[model samples]
Target chain A: MIDQLIEAIIQKKSPIVVGLDPRFNQIPQAIKEKCLAEYGETLEAVAAAIKIFNRGIIDAVADEVPAVKPQVAFYEQYGLPGMAAYLDACQYAASKGLVVIADVKRGDIGSTSKAYAKAHLGQVQVGNKNYQGFPADFATINPYLGDDCMKEFEAEIVQEDKGIFILVKTSNPTSGQLQDLVMADGKHLYEKTAEIVAGWNDKICGKFGYSPVGAVVGATYPEELSALRAQMPKAMLLVPGYGAQGGGAKDVINAFDTKGLGAIVNNSRGIIFAYEKIGGDYQEAARKAVIAMKQDINDTLSSVGKQYW
Target chain B: MIDQLIEAIIQKKSPIVVGLDPRFNQIPQAIKEKCLAEYGETLEAVAAAIKIFNRGIIDAVADEVPAVKPQVAFYEQYGLPGMAAYLDACQYAASKGLVVIADVKRGDIGSTSKAYAKAHLGQVQVGNKNYQGFPADFATINPYLGDDCMKEFEAEIVQEDKGIFILVKTSNPTSGQLQDLVMADGKHLYEKTAEIVAGWNDKICGKFGYSPVGAVVGATYPEELSALRAQMPKAMLLVPGYGAQGGGAKDVINAFDTKGLGAIVNNSRGIIFAYEKIGGDYQEAARKAVIAMKQDINDTLSSVGKQYW
Candidate 1:
């Protein structure tokens, strides 16, 4: 799956992963007006409109980008109906040959963690009933519970060919307060976490020279991004904090290897809700944002003496 | 709400919070048979059986405990219908006058966090339509995204007079690998987080001397719990890792003050699924587990010269 994802990114020559974090307030006014007119403001109707909006964006960008990262919180805010829509969207993206990275950040302990892994990553069979998992190519996970909790996930990755991006250094401002704490060994917590991430990935390296175990190192910390990248050479990097979170192409360039095959830059607000920021027709605004981001990343990589795949 | 929760715990002289993590496979044979006879194995029927089982447990132990913490993952694994049952269980437990602490470790950035907070903690005002929040008296939150992510929840807590317990030191074995990382400033990451938790609660101190902002300091880390308690004197501690997770009553004693009004020990599998461990009638096994847990906590507190209420 990691190899497929890397190949798609290389073939498309795009690092931008449109973040599907839709907010009702951020939807273009025209689209919102049309959606409200078509389907009243009931939760179900609004969620349907959200799905329509997301589908349109995915269709517009599918041929030009490698993947679409859907932030689960926005859809979950609408409850179960919303989650159903989210699942549908994942299927929709996968049907278009796009990698669907479910940004859930789920973490728990032991059997519970296994349940979550089975629920989201692999097929779950109980008696005569069998349910398909979330159908995501990869998922973002919280590593706060420690490596032992991750064992179930690691095992599933091997058995099911799934991938996991463990949160190391986050993009938020306050992340430094804790993730940047110095360890007794004189390394930052995130640095130590990066070392562990590299170690974990060593056990799961795939055919593409990259591992299914990845690290979520924030694009917000460019300097740390380079350092962490150097440390976890074999690990893929899921770089969040781009665009809306104030990170730019230059900041994320170091996150990738020289081949431009090791990183995926995520921009939730910057891409999905671009019409809100730029104020234009919804589809056109979204298309323009995706093109511009793709070019920006390509140019940045090129300048760093790395060919854009 | 913290004050109310503490007062309730002290008045009941029980620190045990019954954890509602119902696994269909692990359910007693009799309960399974009853469910099969009464309802089918479809999600709706299964959820109904789960609700009945949870209601029975709540009925048996409502008078012997302060709260019931339901892990959302267990219910969420069953999808929409299961979520509906979870909501039903929450409403039922609250109607029994038990503080419902939803163990949904949700966390995200800014506005998304606000939506999640609204979904679980604050009310949802859909245009002219009115709806209460999940109606839980309190909720457990994930603080991995940083303090800013918690601001919206803080506002909701102040407005609704509810409470939130932030994950500071989790009980999982691997938690120490990141949480216990020492900083250049000499404070461990969790300790720094404890200081922030204390700051967040300073203005919201309740009449009984506790604050709305609480810390989840795992009982497994007894020494860390004592240290965190010394730092966040005014914050309530929601201790997990009791019973099944390997923490005992004596281990969590440091989380409370001499008044025995500061901590609520959570035992999910240990109480609700006690028949698996104790081997007796389902209800009787659960009742005995609760009684034994309460006695153990009371003895621990009393031995330390702390009055239970």
Candidate 2:
């Protein structure tokens, strides 16, 4: 999975991954009204609007970005219809030849974690038949339960040749409330979390010298990102908090390796809602937004003599 | 919500929550074969088996226990069909006059958390009307993202008068790998997390002198459970790790107040799969299991002069 992601980044000359985190209101007025007319303002209408809106986003950015991350929370609010829409978005993104990352942030006790691993990354057995449940190229995981619980996801990654990004430092305002607490060993909790990621990453490596077992460090904290970058040297970073979350290209510059290939920056609202802020077709605007974002990030890397291209 | 939960505990003379975390193989052969005959070898058959098995368990324990917690991971592995079964189980428990606790340890950034809160505990707006997503009485939440991210769930609790349990010390073997780390303040990380919980719980209490805001302190760690109970005085303790997790009734004594009314102990496999160990009808065995579990818990509490009844 790491090799494939790296290959995509090199081919596109952009280490950018678009986030398909859509809100109902964020969907174009035209699309929303059409769906409402068709489904009579039901949850089905909401799902339809999201699917259509996501289709536009994927078509626009599929050629520009290496991956598309769909935050499950956004679609989950509408109930069963919402889940259907979430699955459709994932399938559509895959059909476009884009790496689909399910930003699920799931983890649990070992036995339960095995079920979640099967839900997102592997196959589940039903009598003599086996079926995949919401399969994706990568999924996000929560690490609060520690290494023993993560064994299931680790096993799934090995069995399916897939990937996962475990949370280290999040981008929320109070993220440091717990993450920055100094431990008895004089290391912050997030730093300790990064050390754990580095250890796990060492057990698995791809052709590009990166691990499929990656880490998520928010782009909101540049210094912490830089520090974690050095701490988990082989980890591929899924750096969220870009754009709408107040993380500029310069703010996330340190997330990259010397060759500008170790990180994928996610921008959701800024690119998907570009049409609302800039008057034009939503798809065309999203396409332009992706191009502008890629250029901004590449420019920052080049200024530091780290641009691969 | 806390008052209602307290009233139910008083009426039932039990502070027990039956965990409906079923594994497919654990289902009685009769139920499994019936579902397989009905739906063939498909995810539908798996969902059918879960719904039927859960109904039997709920029917057996509804009069004995005040609440039932349905862990989502077990159902999620079957995809859309599994999710449908999960909702059915929640609704069935509610229909049986039992409080439904959706044991989904979900958390994320504020926006994402809002969607999750709506999905499980509150109403989501669609166009002109509001629709429910899953609508459990309470939901378990993961607290790795900190307080700012929790504001959404907090708001949902306030608006809908629902409840949530935040993970403090989990039941897994390696939960201590991160939770038991000594902080610079000379306290464990879980202790600091308990302090945070205590602070939040103080704000939103109910008529029963308890808060709808709760904390999950595993029964597996008796010492930590006792300490956390003292730390978060007003917060209800959702104690997991009972029964099949190697925790006896005596092991969970510390999770309660002197009245033995401030905590709910959860037992999954031990009660749900009792027919496999003890003969007779599955429903009858489940009823006897719940009765024995309640007696074991009450007797332990009485020995310590903490029995509420």
Candidate 3:
């Protein structure tokens, strides 16, 4: 899955992954009304509308990006029906030949963590049958519980050729409150996390000089992004906090390696809700938005003499 | 919800919440065969079998415990059918007057965090209707993302009288990797988190003098538990790692106040899979296990002269 994502990035000439993080306000009124009329104003109706909204954006950008990350929280907000929509979006995006990153930042202890790993990236067995639940090629994980908690996920996903982006430095305003804490050895908490990710990558280097084990380096912090990029050279970064969250192309470009292929910047609301700002068909606007983002990122990569494609 | 949970704790004379974390190997052979015969050994069969298994345990221990913590990862491993079992267990447990604490350690940033808060502890609005997702009285949250990520959950759940338990000092063997890190200001990371939880409690103090905001302080580290209990006096403690994970009754007792009303201990495998250790019907073994746990904890509380009931 990691090699495939890297290949898609080179072929598309864009290190970009669209984030399918739909909220009620982001969905077009027309789409909502259409689904509401069909299913009424219930969780079922709202979830149906979200699925429609996700499919439109996915269809619009499938040809231009490497992957699409569906934040589970958005779909989970609507309950079972909402989760049904989440599963549908993941399947539809993968069917479009794009890698699906289930952005479920799940982590826990041993046996419990294995359950999460099996649900998202591996297989669960019942008698002679194996079931794939929300089969995203990769998933995001929170590493707060330490290496023991992560070992299960590594055995389940990375060992199976799938991947995971462990949360190192998140993009939120107050993330520094915990992630920036200094350890006994003088490295910041996130730096320690990056070091662990880098060491893990050494165990599973891929054909592209990278590893399926990745690190989530928030693009909002350019200094940290640059420092982390140097710290974990082989890690494919899943960069978030771009566009709507105040991370710009200039800020995220620091995450790219000398080869310009080490990171995938994700823009959720900036692309999915582009229709509101662009005043055109949502799908076309989404497509145009992806192209514009691609151009913006490519311009940076080219300026830095790192544009491989 | 904080006051309600306390009241239930006193009425039941037990500050114990049974952990409904089931695995495939834990289910009785008879139950598995019956469900597999009916549903063909598919995910459906395993999930149905789990639902039945959960209901039996819930019925057995409902009179002895204040709540039941169903770790979502177990049900999630089976996919949608497993999730259906999870929801069924939560609903059935709640119907029996037990506070259903959904042990989904979920956390993210800003709007994403709000979506999670609304899904587990609050309601989602769709046009003129509001629908409850999981409807757990409380949910566990990961605080590694820091205060901004936690505020949304506080506003959504605390304001509505529901509650959340923020991870502070986890009981895992390697939890100290990040949690015990010394900050520049000299406080440990978990201690810093405890201070924040305590401050949040000041804003939403319930009738019982505790806030709806709570902390997850693992029982395995009795010294840390004692220190954190003092640091967050107005906050309730959801102490995991009690029986199965090497935390004994003596270790968890420190999480309680002088009145023995500030904490609830959880024992998953020690109770749910008790049949494996004792030769009896699974439900009977589970009931006996709960009774013994309640007795063990009560004795410890009584010896300390902190028995509120």
TM-score against native, each model: 0.94, 0.99, 0.98
- Which rank order by TM-score, best down to worst? 2, 3, 1
The CAPRI classification for model 1 reads as acceptable
* Model 2 steric clash pairs: none
Candidate 3 Cα outliers beyond 4 Å, as residue runs: none
lDDT of 3: 0.89
Q: Arrange candidates by lDDT, highest first: which order?
A: 2, 3, 1
For candidate 3, write residues A140-211 as lDDT tens digits.
989888777778887765566789999999999988887888876688989978877988888887899888
lDDT of 1 by residue, A115-228 (tens): 677666776554576655456888888877678767878767888888999888888887876677777678988888887888887787978789999999999999999999
The pairs that clash in candidate 3 are none
Per-residue alpha-carbon lDDT of model 1 for B1-309, expressed as tens digits?
Answer: 777887788788887789999887777777677766665656665677788889989998999998999887777766666677788888999999999998878776676788778767776644465445355878887777777677879877988888899899999888887777787777777887887798887878898778888989999999999988888888989999998889988899999887777888899888888888889777788899999998898888888888556
TM-score of 1: 0.94
Worst 10 residues of 3 chain B by lDDT: B152-161
Best by lDDT: 2
Worst ten-residue run, lDDT, model 2 chain A?
A148-157
